[model samples]
Target: MAELRTEEEQVEALKRWWKENGLSLVAGVALAAAGVLGWNTWQGYQENQATAASMRYQQLVNLTAGNDLDEAQLPEARALVDEIVDEHGKTLYADLARLMDARLAVAQGDLAGARERLQSLADAGSDNYVAGLARLRLARLLVAEGDADQALNVLQSGVPEALAAQRAEVRGDAYHALERREEAATAWREALRLAATNEQPLYGVQLKLDNLGLESPDLEGSALETSSRDTTSHDNRGLDA
Candidate 1:
């Protein structure tokens, strides 16, 4: 009977040990799991905040469209854009805002200011699309200022494939302005080739060819006179019949 009591006591002690330490072990593991979940939730919240900042940046863009920089509202728009860029420069919208601001400066006829803004965007690292746009616009401004050589240099340096047709067309215009007719024609031809078939305007290409005294088979006929006569006859028939 004593041996039996000793065995019962040993079993009860084992049960107590398991009840106390096992519960604590399980609780510890659960706490560690919860901590991981909490960390992930915090990271997601931070990402969401950055995304909201970007959306606000886009709203600033809509507000500034076609608005004169000298107006009262312009300062407010600029302030919002600047805030986003300063606070969330890592966001894609920040880079886009800089490009938008530079374009606005250009539209306002602030060539010096535009160039300065564009230069900053161009030098910003890892923004290939914006940098390319800056270079292309800067080249156009240079051409407008009668700096054909510099414009050509900008084109020769590099331009993105998406802007190739526009670059070629502008370069052709610059060359034509410089009295380099052959170069202009060559550039225009390249532009025509690069342009999508459906998107390219045939009349503009024909005009360019004519400016270079180049004969275009497409414009060979007196189609305009015939169309005009047909339209006149149609109008007269309604009156007569």
Candidate 2:
């Protein structure tokens, strides 16, 4: 009779403990499970979004791959580019689409449209490489439009090291246009030096220097002769001017 009483007391104590803590323990487990499920759902959603963006960007690329786009195909290509820009405006794909859109506008003789697109990318702070490329293109267009001062201003805004050679060349063009011969020569010399450092040959810079009565050391006889033949025609061409 004594042992039975003791077992009953122990059973009662366990029941009381569970009654005090069971609901809280159950609730804590439920909350943890819910949190994990929510995080997995969010991860899945982001993966799906990235996949959709990649597919759309590939479609855009296919539409613009070749130089054989005829008049009828151009509108469709441009429409696709616009759609990517509208839907994925904050993505890298959208920035690339803007560049392609600008090129399309140039092809269609829409200089104003092209300029606007290029200027938007140039002024944006998102991607330094894209901004630098846009600045270079815009500067070239401005120079072609006879706005050399504006071109120079654009180049002065700064560029990536990868674009330094091209920028200097265009600066030379702008200076030449403004009749700043000394400045033009200096810019071209810098461009040539940069190109050499990059292991890229700037073929005509030396020719231009020669026209300016400047000599490049160790130029081959055949090269000098060939360059002289074209000096009169190419002296004013300026690198990518």
Candidate 3:
């Protein structure tokens, strides 16, 4: 005859197993739920911060656009930007605030301050589009500071491909300042070739070419002569009277 275990024995074995492993399983589930809630809270906090920063930034923009910004208003704008940068430096709005600060510094003739802000942005490694603009503007400031070598170096080395034409133009200007005429001419030509039709001013490139002793074709005269010939032909056709 086989021996049979009582139902009580099976229930006790299950209780022992639950006692050993059940708490661990419950703890894991609790941790996962906490993690999900924490992530959602963090996301909501970020959204709220971004919204507030955007509103502040818009106010700054309106001040500038309305021409209500003076030296007094500059401080207010600066304070707001500083606040946003300190609180939400990782946000897109922070990058915009930095750019605005740089522009305001330039307008105030605080070139050194502007250069510093732009350099910081260029090195931020967060937003490449803004970084590219920062590098380009920094190069211009360096050029204005008579730091031709440093400006040329920045343009040549730091500029991204999207701003290559502008960089080449600035490089040409730097070369010209350094009296490297041949190099300047080459850079200008490269800039002309790389610049988009809407982005580049033809007259500016023509002026550069003229400075380099390159001849510009007299398109006006050709157009005038064609118009005269067309007028003469039209007049002849009407002369039957």
Q: Give the winner by TM-score.
A: 2
Q: What are the TM-scores, per candidate, against the unseen true structure?
A: 0.62, 0.65, 0.63
What TM-score does prediction 2 earn? 0.65
Quantify how close model 3 is to the true structure by its C-alpha RMSD in Å. Answer: 24.7
Candidate 1 residue pairs in clash (backbone atoms < 3 Å): none
Which stretches of candidate 2 lie above 4 Å from their native place?
Answer: 1-48, 65-69, 199-213, 217-241
Q: Which residue pairs clash in candidate 2? A: none
lDDT of 3: 0.60
Tens-digit per-residue lDDT, 1-241, candidate 1: 2123222322343354446556764465466657566756655665686678757775775676442444666667767768878887755557666766665565555678877876677677234555665676666667667787877887785566755765777788678768898888887666666554324221254356555786433322243222212211111110000
Lowest summed-lDDT stretch of 10 residues in model 3?
Answer: 232-241
Question: Candidate 1 vs candidate 3: which has greater lDDT?
Answer: 3
What is the per-residue lDDT of model 3 for residues 1-241, given as tens digits with 9 covering 90 to 100? 0001112222333354356556874565456657566756655664587689778767766654432237777878888888878987865567767876876786676877888888888888365655766776677677667788998777656566755765777787788778898888887666666654324222254356555785433333332233223211110110000
Error of 1 at 62 (Å): 1.4
Off by over 4 Å in 3: 1-45, 65-69, 197-207, 210-213, 216-241
